[model samples]
Target: MADELTTRSALQLRDLVAHGEVSAEEVARAHLERVAATDDQLKAFVTVTDDAALAHARDIDRRRAAEEPVGALAGVPLALKDVLCTKGVRTTCGSRILQTYRPPYDAGVVERLRDADVVVLGKANCDEFAMGSSCENSAFFPTRNPWDLDRVPGGSSGGSVAAVAGFQAPLGVGTDTGGSIRQPAALCGLVGVKPTYGAVSRYGLIAFASSLDQAGPIARSVTDAAHLLAAIAGPDPRDSTSIPKPLPDVLAGLDDGVSGLRIGVVAEFMAEGMSDGVRAMVEASVERLAGLGAEIVEVSLPHAGYGLAAYYLIAPSEASSNLSRYDGVRYGLRVDGATTEAMMAATREAGFGSEVKRRIMIGTYALSAGYYDAYYAQAQRVRTLIARDFAAAFETCDVLVGPTSPTVAFPLGELTADPLAMYANDVYAVPASLAGLPAMSLPVGLGEAGMPVGFQIMAPLLRDDLMLRAARALEAEVGFDAMPRGPNALAGAAI
Candidate 1:
């Protein structure tokens, strides 16, 4: 029953609960059992809320018994990336500094989830402060890919994607600063959406890069992601930057196929460095869309090569500023040393992992007096050029298409020694993020690594529904969810 329940989509489970085919308590219990049976190897969760989930499930059962109104997501169990706060839950952003820190209130998204009657499973693991492209930076433990445990699950949302793909949960939330969500979604073969900047409120998500950070959903299918987005998206007075637009009928838009729409296949994507397998898959995706009656247009974004360099500078600079509050004074782990100031320095030095410190130092240097103009300011201007490039490309087409990443999932330790190479992993994703465009990752097919390869679909800012509609069409046409290996293949392996 647990395996059967875990395999179902969140919408399917919701319907079952609503129709009394299964009770909320049973669904919640089944998820908890799956988590217990699998999480030790996956390390997908930073914390699991067994008690709170069951209690919420009981409350749902009681409400249903009284015939009270329940939200569409009533009793659906979902996991949140630890980057989002939850009241009293140890919302460690996979960093040692915040290992013991618990927030006093729920994040805006968490409140929305509660209102939707979704049960909180726990906080998923993430790269420290959402910095690394892989989950390896997590001070707790790395989240391995469910498909191949020895390989990485693209991150900083690795845990959330792994949790969903590993059948720990049906849906989860993830943030994309520079392809953090989409890259991982592509790697994990799940549908990951990074809505237009300001489309979803960032009130409770720990700041990564203020301008680039936006939260959305990660689920097994395009429809599931759309449903989760509908539940959490809307204006939140708490986040001043949040767009106050009315939610789109995302679920209703799922049936809109890719007929007579113009799809842009960015020429830069097919340039040198893209693996043959990835190119073949993306080309196949274009053919599939063409078969669906969509026109394929070749578009150029000349300055896209600068996206990675600009993103590293800007993201780290903002991270340096946002992380200044953690001086071991107000919150998080503190060190016991000679003096107050010394202890603060020691705490940070000892608590933060090597990668986190490296980025912070890089960011601090970029923002420092002499280097500010050359690094930070220059990066911002380059950002402007990239945005302009997107504007020009969008003029010719309704959506942009490309392989989500250059290659498929690699072994866990493959790129650890080369930080620049690891950062380059997001080459395809950072461009959309820098432009603040709405982009989603839909699995196209398996690549040479026997793991999923996702095709990224980018729509103009605030055109999230069109992006979803296009992705749903492609997803339906190229169904890639069929697992390559049996569950027993991963039986004793840690993901």
Candidate 2:
């Protein structure tokens, strides 16, 4: 019965708790036990807050018993990516520097989650400072894809998505800066959302690429993703970039099928480089959408090819600026030296990992005198062009469709030796981030090695509801079997 509870969707669990069929404590314990059982193999979490979770669950049960008002996601268990600040709980962005650093206050989204009565199971792992495409860059440990133990769970939200996919959590919150959330959600066979920039507050989220980082939901189903998005989507005065308006009704028209919706297929995305199996699966997904009455059209984003190069420059430059606050004098790890400059250098050298160092170097170089205009400034220009492409394309289509990644989950260390190869994993997902548009990845089917392939749906800026509606429509048609298979399936079953 506990394992059965673990397999249920977030909404299903919520319903059970609401109807008195089961206590929230039972649901929380079920997932916590699953995490304990599998995290050694999955490495999906940096910390597990069993006590806090049970306390929150019991509180929710008390509120229900008293007939008091409860938030939308009351008692749902969730995994939070370590990038979000959690008061008194260590939030390590998968780096040694801030491994012991606990925020004095919660991030805006975290506060909202608490208000919604969501029980955070723990802090999920990620690439050090959310800089890498694969979780292997973690200063602590790499997260393995649940579909195949030897493969990487896509990152920097690898652990967050893995928790959901591996049945350790029903929902997860992860920040997407250049595909961190969606890519991992793809590899893990989950519904991952990258809401439009400012759709969710970025106030307490540790900076990556400020312009690109947006926190969103990773869930087992599209409907669950929408519910999670609703809980955290409103404006926050703490975040200057937050959209100063009420969030749209995402669940209002979620069930309205995409009968007459126009879904544009990016001609460039279909050209080459992706594995044949992934391409076939994505193409089949598009066909399935068409069969469900979506109007299919081929659209061109001539500047789309440059998105990768532009992102590498722009994201790194921003990272360099944001990370400079981590000098020896501040809150996180500090290495002492004879002089201030020496201490700063020593602290950074000791604190940051190899990938973080590589990006800081690239970013500093790009932002250096005489090179800013040629690199960082030009990347910003390319960003504008990419946004223009999305705007122009959206004029003819309601949303764009493509493969979330070039291939499914790859073995650990496969691309670790080649940074360029690792960066290419975001080729399909980055354009939406660069454009600050809303995008999502949902499993269409399995591809090579029996790993999941995601079909991405993107909408114009501030149109997250539209994007999710299309995803839900297709999700209903595809009926993706999100259950884990093989040995991993047995793990969940035995939990």
Candidate 3:
């Protein structure tokens, strides 16, 4: 029963809890035990709030007993990416500088989760300040992929997706700036959603790239991802960037078949450079979608090749500005120096990791006086072109399809020395983010190294429901089995 509960989808667990078939406490404890048993090997969690999770579970049980109205995800266990502030809980963003820091208020998503009665297992690990493509950049420790213990789980939401994929949690909340959520979800063989930018509130979320960063859901199935997304997505007064309109009903049309829907396959994404296995798997998935009655059309994003270069400049520039608040004089780490300037320098030098520092330097240089127009401004112009590309492509199709990542999860330390290789992992994913459109990664099949290959579905801004509908249709055709077979294979077997 415990194992069954651990492996169940969030919606399934919620239904079971709602029907009184299982108490919320029992469900929470089952997942807690799974985390305790598997997280040591997976290293997905930065903190495990077992006591708090149980306490929340007990409250949910009381509510159910009293016949009080419970939210859609009443008893679901969730893993929150460490980047979202969780009130009294430590929100590290996987950086040592804020290791001991705890926010006085919960992020908008956290508040929504609490309101929905979802029990947070703990804060999941991520890249330092949400900055890297691999979990190796985490200041605490790298989160290993559950499919192969020696390979990396993608980042900066590595721990969030890892937790769900490893059966430690039924669902997770992760932020996506440059495919942080989708890339990791792809590598982990889970469903990851990046809602249209500003559709989900960013208030209380530790800023990475303020304009680009948006929080969304990670789950084992499309239905589960839709349920979680509904709970946390909506307008928030605290976030100026948040859209004031009501969120579309993501689940209402989720099961709607994609009979006449046109799916645009980006011509450039299929050109070359990825492993043959990955390309073949993605093509097979596309064929499957076509087989399911959806029309497949070839669409070209002429400037797609420039997405990586533009994203690096825009995201890092925003990150550079947003991270400026962490000076020694403020709340995070402080190192003594002869003067204030030296102290701030020492603090940042000691607090940031190599990847974070690299981005900061590049961003600082891009935004510097003489180079601003040459770099930052030009990058912004390129961003506009990318968005325009998506706009033009959407006119010919209901949604776009592509491989989530060019390659599957690589072995640990494989790309550590090559930053460009790491950045290339987000090549296909960055274009949607740059356009502020809704996109999701659904596990379609296994590729090279027997790791998961993700099929990306993207919809125009505010049309998340359309994207999810297409994903659900494709998901049924793909029939992906997300069971991993590494150190936690026994745990999964028990499930």
lDDT digits (tens) for residues 1-495 of candidate 3: 766798788888999999899999999989988888888889999999999999999999998899888877998999999999988888899998898998999999999999899999999999999998888999999998989878898998999989998988989999999999999999999999999999999999999998899999999999999989999999999999999997799989999889999999999989987788889989998999889899999999999899999999999998888888888786889999999999989999999999999999999999998999999899899989989999999999999998899999998899999999899999999999999999999999899878898989999999999999999998998889988965434256233
Measured over all alpha carbons after superposition, the RMSD of each candidate to the real structure, in angstroms, is: 1.9, 1.0, 1.2
Deviation in Å, model 2, residue 195 alpha carbon? 0.2
Between candidates 2 and 3, the one scoring higher on lDDT is 2
Which stretches of model 3 miss by more than 4 angstroms?
486-495
Native-referenced Cα lDDT, model 2: 0.93
Error of 1 at 319 (Å): 0.3
TM-scores, all candidates, are: 0.97, 0.99, 0.98
User: Which residue pairs collide, candidate 1?
Assistant: none
| Regions of candidate 1 where Cα sits further than 4 Å from its true position | 1-3, 337-339, 482-495
Which residue pairs in model 3 clash with each other? none
Worst 10 residues of 1 by lDDT: 486-495
| Residues forming the 10-long window of minimal summed lDDT in candidate 2 | 485-494
